[model samples]
Target: MDHSIRLQIEEREAASLAPYATLSRETKGRFRPEEECPIRGAFQRDRDRIIHCKSFRRLKHKTQVFLAPTGDHYRTRLTHVLEVSQIARTISVALRLNGHLTEAIALGHDLGHTPFGHAGEAVLDELYPQGFRHYDQSLRVVNILEKKGEGLNLTVEVLDGIAKHSKGRREILPEDLSELPATMEGRVVRIADIIAYVNHDLDDAVRAGILSESQIPSHLQKLFGPTHSGRIGAMVHDLVVQTLKNGGEILAMTPNLLEGIAELRSFLYENVYETNRVHDDFIKAKKVLRELYEYFINKDDHWEKVIDYDETTPREQMVCDFIAGMTDRYALDLYTNIFLPKPWSVM
Candidate 1:
């Protein structure tokens, strides 16, 4: 069989996709260019690379919300990324944008997230001199940590989308366009990230018995809908309608939908994320990471155990990298090994 499938797909993209879509053929290309695959376009290739990388696989054991949740149904980082990819692709397809690029961005967006979710992030941000943000760490994962530091070598478009997907406690569609990802596909992932997390987090909170459905603000329930799927559907529909109405030049949501989402986020911050029960665990998780950070930095023997440690890299940065890459179970087990007394056994 002829192996010119990539070329054929590129031709189809140009013939069918929107004017503003980020086509695979038009990628800014990887930092270190290699021979193109015969069967995959650049963005599709990027998506595959991200999916197969070690860092992406670690996402399954990482926290999304509820710290080390015992419940089978709570969202892990992997599930959250999948949800974001699904929603982003739906929007991209509606807008006639490149779904592959959108899925690539979504899949790679949270590759750098820490164990115990944002709690671990807060601890790293305070301890590290330069401060830590998961988005930057995620970029570092692809650029320097994965594949024995050879890196994923993904396209610039994917990297840009991954780097800029984060919007911490800010408006979904900010007044500053510069803060957003460069491509329309990237913007789709950005919105989809928040949409996925907000609804899923709320659902998890209710499932965990932390918040009753009645506790959710009546106005938001009315504005979006009463159920999780209802809320997500409303937001996704609004986003597609507004973006299409604006001719796909910019990704957008209706003013009311944006306001509702912002309010819902604030409610979660106060009631779910920052409440006493959650905050207590967050504090304990911070201590675990902080002690691990100190132990690894001060003890060369401990540092040597790190799989990717390099003598040339700063000890502090190496510690941060190791800690950030850890899964929730790994972090907890390591903590127990380092700090907790083992059973007295003499064989």
Candidate 2:
């Protein structure tokens, strides 16, 4: 009887993966110990857990670039993560790294982003006395809030990837090892995330008519090419070629292409992200989240009706977690029910 399918995979990894690859059998282990699965490796289990989690399902309704976009094709937070998974896996396989770990990180990376995109995050940041960041909140979600507070019990490697994957307009790959993911797989997700967003956001901007294909800076258009797939292909090709050239000891990219990608990101911020057409709705989104935060934090009697609470946890923290977990339409619908006037007919 083949009782240990997992052992075969682990053995294959040792035989096939790059020397730098993080092996599933060598995981740092989960927060809580679990019985070894008969069939799957650690990272494989992690990927399955994230895909089935409630927060992962909520991503479909969460904002990406556009808040409550009326169009069907606009990228939602769900779509963004899927794209990142594809790009990261592609790079991981090319480098002979741990593709399972890469997929797990990519899928779970944005699980804690607030509804209504950054506008909602901004509201929570201001409203929470300790302040908020989606990356930190993501860790909090997996550790304390998921599975009705049992938490996900994910591997420490996956947890580290989720925590450190955020770039936030900073260096895409920081020089400080402290600022980078503990594994090369995590770093791949970081770069893939930016590549997914910068390219897709630009595509959405054009699709939304916020700008035209011609309005983009000519140098960027030439470098990335005119099509969406072409641009992502160009970016991924450069990264793979350069990283392999560096002996896989470090993830590397040519300075010229790196700077070119950076310029393309800057161009989007100037031409699409900040323009009145896009910025105006986010301003309104902030207001919705702000009102919701205030209503929950200040009105304790009413809050008890909605949030299941224990006296030990701070109310503000509970409220912040509750808000950040919401999907875009769910936030709006809740706000309307709580704050908007309902038509009344006297009987």
Candidate 3:
């Protein structure tokens, strides 16, 4: 079949996208080279691959901030990534950067997040000899874990974006750009992650009755706004406006807004993330994950059926992959089956 439409789209990208935008035609290529699609550009193809992957499906069941929150409105990992994608796309589109690459990176950024969120990750980091990081695990998911160890073979731009999307509690924007991702789309995802979580997590905290709207620092509300949509709108507007004013050479936001975001993050840490309501559940999650890890590592009679990534891989790494791959419900169910006593019943 003729593939001229793909070339036409590429030409359109070149004419319309900014000079710094990562053009789909100029992609750095995937880990394993393959023929190009007739309709989709490289980044678009990568986005499709991520969306169709098993890990992507599991995200709906994984934790974002709240651990197995009973409320329906809590942000699971799936919704968190979608929010990040939306914010990132808005920024990328405004800057004339590659929205496709930004979207692909944003969607795949949290694929490696643990079942119970950071609590599960913390447990693995302590118990595993090599330590654990969700970002690296995200790369591992796209690089080795997905497709029965064949990997997604995503483009270099997308891979770079996923690998560096996280900043933890560190600086939101460092003076050195090298510390950030290689492409502008990747950088957009990085900042968008912060934007998505701080706002949504705070919203969730309010919903969970852990924090009231009035309790949030007044300055944050004034700067970002009192409502969730207003807060996101203000932040996105600042990012686009500041970056455009700086000629789009670098992503920039007014120091006041940046500082405001940081302060809001700090408040969440002190009042929401570290508070007893959240931490108490995390404590229990930690126990369940720890015991499950030890059991699987030591007892190998039937784990392969569930975690058969590769027969050659070391059991420890395989177990780590399995645990990282589990959804909150799956992990809980497995724990209950393995550790809890069942009453005898009629046969």
**All candidates: TM-score:** 0.97, 0.97, 0.98
Model 3, residue 41: what's the lDDT?
Answer: 96
The candidate scoring highest on TM-score is 3
Q: What is the alpha-carbon lDDT for the whole of candidate 3?
A: 0.92
lDDT of 2 at 346: 100
Relative to the unseen true structure, what is the C-alpha lDDT of residue 147 in candidate 1, on a scale of 0 to 100? 86
What's the lDDT for candidate 2? 0.90
lDDT of 1 at 241: 92
lDDT of 1 by residue, 109-169 (tens): 9999999999999999999888999999999999988888788899999999999999999
TM-score of 2: 0.97
lDDT string for model 2 (131-160, tens) is 999999889878878887788899999999
Query: Per lDDT, what order, best first?
Result: 3, 1, 2
Candidate 3 Cα errors over 4 Å, as ranges: 305-312
Candidate 2 C-alpha error for residue 299, in Å: 2.3
* Candidate models: Cα lDDT each: 0.91, 0.90, 0.92
